[model samples]
Target chain A: EAGVAQSPRYKIIEKRQSVAFWCNPISGHATLYWYQQILGQGPKLLIQFQNNGVVDDSQLPKDRFSAERLKGVDSTLKIQPAKLEDSAVYLCASSLFIGGAVKQQFFGPGTRLTVL
Target chain B: DQQVKQNSPSLSVQEGRISILNCDYTNSMFDYFLWYKKYPAEGPTFLISISSIKDKNEDGRFTVFLNKSAKHLSLHIVPSQPGDSAVYFCAAGGGTGTASKLTFGTGTRLQVTL
Candidate 1:
């Protein structure tokens, strides 16, 4: 089976620019997630969606970051007015929902964003 | 405040030896812990996991030990191979009133030499 898929594996933009990343999760998976991983650090959860509805986004930077999952399959994460500090890898993950919540998650090749 | 922490930035082990990576979490609510191995330019792959109710879980060459009272866990790989060299991350999850959200630690880079 194919794993989660992400677009534009690498991206470079100037500070204050807007950038977007896309993700297509595994078929039949009911949960999708977006995470940010700074160099030398683990991926941090940014937002999570279950069937086209947000399940959690408490760590999302509401002032600049936004995400959406359409039809419970594909997702997009956007960062407007990106800052140099935002230079990190954006990872997308998906998992099959079981017994009310997802267990193990399968990750995608992340999009590495660099803000100059 | 980081909830999960992998204190060792890197570790080196000779092939055929054992490689142990450690992790500690500050939150007591975490009941499920997982370890992921990642290679350069690729996404992390789940290695092994242990639930709080269990103290140890093993899969072939990899074993995970959980010490719930201390809020600590460790991943052990036996007969480490060259292909096992990668950054290993430990993640924790489980809480109330929320979907299971993972909190990961900074990774520990493992180097296995032949």
Candidate 2:
């Protein structure tokens, strides 16, 4: 079976530029999540989308960060006026959120963003 | 403040020996726990998990032990192999009775040497 897929595995941008990463989850997974993983640290949840609607985005920096999961299958995470601190690996994950507690989340090969 | 923490940044174990990686969480409400493994440039892959109601759960060579009172959990790999060397992350999930979004630990780099 195919795992979650993400685009532009690596990205480099200037501190003030805008960057976007895309993710395509496995078929039929309902819950989608975006996380930022800094070097030497764990991946922190930025936002979560259930179907086409958002569940949690409290950690998202709304002023510069944005994400949309249209049609409920694919998602895009955008960072505008990127700050140097935003340089990190952007990971996309999905899960079968329908049954039993929480199932294992399948992760995509993250997009490593480097903001210079 | 970090809710989940893996104090040891790395651990070295001899091949065929047992390797234990530990994690601690601050939230008492977390009801589900999981361990993930990741290689460089790849995303994390789920290893195993234990529900809050259970003190122990085992899967083949991997076992997860939870001590809810202490808010601590550990993952033990038996007869550790070089192929098992990777960064291990412990995550906690549970809330609102839905599939939980996870809160991950910093990660522990496990190296199995011959």
Candidate 3:
């Protein structure tokens, strides 16, 4: 089975530039997530989507970051006016939903964004 | 207030030895725990998991032991191989309303050398 897929394994941009990362989850997976992993730190949840509907995005910085899973299969995460602090790896993950039980999330290689 | 923590940043062990990595969580709401291994430039892959109801779970040469009362968990790799050298992350899940979101520790980098 193909694992979660992401585009542009590496990205570099200048501050104030807008950058977008794409993710295509595993087929038949119903839950998708976006996470930011800074150097030396664990990945932090940026947002979660349950079949095109947002399940949680409390940690997301809505002012500069936004994500959507319109078709619920592939998703995109965008950052506008990117700052140097935004330099980090953007990871996408997906998991199968069995009834109401949540399962292990499979992750993509991730896009390493470096804002200069 | 970090919810999950891996105090040791790195560990080195000779091949064929046992490698132990520790993790602690402050949130008692966590009902499920997991361990993930990651290689450089690759995303983390699930290694093993344990539910709150179980104190220990083993897969192949990897064993995870949980101590609920102490909010501590450890991952043990026996007869460690060089391929086992990677960053290991401890993650906790399940809370009152958190759903499937996982809280992860900083990670422990283990180097298994021959």
Candidate 4:
């Protein structure tokens, strides 16, 4: 089966500029997630979507970052006025949610954003 | 605050030897633990997982042991292969309404040499 798919494997933007990343999760997957991985650190959860509805986004910086999954299939994460500290890899993951049971999450290659 | 931590930043082992990576978590709410392996420029892939009820779980050459009292876990690879070289991350999740929300460790880089 095909795994999660992301676009623009790499991106470069100047500080204060805006950037967007796209993600298309595995077909039939009910849960989607966005994460940020800084150098030498593990991936940190940014937001989660359960069928186009947000499940969790407590860690997301609302002042600069936002994400949406309109159809529950594909998602987009956007950052406005990007800062140097925002330079990191953006990873998208999906999993099948069954009766609230924990499932393995399949990840995409990720989009590396470099803010200069 | 960092709930999960992999204190060892890196480890090197000769081929055909055993490799052990350790992880510690401070959150008592975590009841499910998972290990993921990642290569450079690639996203992490699920390797193995264990529930709190089980002290040990093994799949082929990879085994994960969880000690609830100590809030520590470990991954052991026997007869390690060169292909096993990658960054290993430990993740934890549990509690009501947060089973799917995982907290990950900083990761431990492991290299196998021949």
Candidate 5:
């Protein structure tokens, strides 16, 4: 089966500019997530969507970052007025949610955003 | 604060030897732990996992052990292969409504040499 897909494997933008990343999850997956991985650090959860509805986004920076999954299949994460600290890889993941069980999350190659 | 931590930055082991990676978590609410393997320029892939209800789970050459009282966990790879060189991340999940939300640690890089 095909795995999660993301676009523009790499991106570069100037500080204060805006950037957007896209993600298309695996087929039939009910849950999607966005994460940020800074250099030498593990991926940090940014937001989660369960069928186009947000499940969690407490860690997201509302002042600069936003995400949406309109059709519950593909998602987009946007950062406005990007700062140098926002330079990191943006990873997208998806999982099949079945009640209370913890499902395995499949990840995409990720978009590397470099803010100069 | 970091809820999950993999203190080792790197490890090198000869092929055919056993590799052990350790992880510690500070959150008592975490009941499920997982390990993910990642290559440079690639996203992390699920490797193995264990639930808090069990102390050990094994799959082929990989085994995961969880010590609830110590809030620690470990992943063991036996007869390690060169292809096993990658960054390994430990992640934990649990809570009332956020059971699917995972908190990850800064990974440990393992190199299997011949």
Candidate 6:
């Protein structure tokens, strides 16, 4: 099976500008997630989607960030008025489900966003 | 607040030696622990994992030890190879059954030299 797919491996934008990143998870996976990883840090969960519905997004920066998983298949994460602090790698991942005999998460090559 | 932590920012080990990476978590509710290895420019790959009920889990050359009483865990790589050099991250998964969400720690970069 093909791994999770993401578009535009890298992006550079000016501060206060808007940008978007896209991800297509592995087929048959029921859970999708978006995470941010700053340099030298671990990936931080931004939002999680269990199919077409959201499971958790408590850690998401609501004021500036928003995400959507249309048709419960692919997902897109957007950041408006990007801040310098938002410069980090955005990763998208998927799992078969939150509850099951399998619990491993498969990750895609992340989109590295650099805000000037 | 940082709930999970990997205090060591980096570690260097000689090839064929033992490489031990440590992690500590502050939450007792975390019952499932996992280790992921990430190479540059690539996403992380799951290495090994252990449930709270067990103390050790092994996979090929990698082993993970969990100490529930201490809220600590360690990943040991035996006969460490240069290819094993990568950033290692430890994650503590919450709850039982299906609701377990993972809280990850700051990664530790490991460098193995020949």
| RMSD for each of the candidates | 1.6, 1.1, 1.3, 1.2, 1.3, 1.4
Tell the DockQ for candidate 5. 0.62
Off by over 4 Å in 6: A98-102, B97-100
Docking model 4 quality class: medium
Residues B1-114, candidate 2: write the lDDT tens digits.
899999999999999999999999998878888999999999999999888879999999999999999999999999899999999999988564333778999999999999
What does candidate 4's lDDT look like per residue over B6-110, in tens digits?
999999999999999999999999988899999998999999988888999999999999999999999999989999999999999866433488899999999
- CA lDDT of every candidate: 0.92, 0.93, 0.93, 0.93, 0.92, 0.91
State the lDDT of candidate 2 residue by residue for A12-86, as single tens digits: 999999999999999989889999999999999999998999999999999999999999999999999899999
Pick by DockQ: which candidate is best?
A: 2
Interface alpha-carbon RMSD, every candidate: 2.6, 1.8, 2.4, 2.1, 2.4, 2.3
Which residues of candidate 4, in runs, are more than 4 Å off? B96-99
- Could you tell me the C-alpha RMSD of candidate 2 in Å? 1.1
Which should have the higher lDDT, number 2 or number 3?
3
Give lDDT for model 1: 0.92
The CAPRI category of model 6 is medium
Worst 10 residues of 5 chain B by lDDT: B92-101
> What is residue A45's positional error in candidate 4, in angstroms?
0.5
TM-score of 1: 0.97
Error of 2 at B97 (Å): 5.8
Worst 10 residues of 5 chain A by lDDT: A96-105
TM-score of 5: 0.97
Off by more than 4 A, model 1: A99-101, B96-99
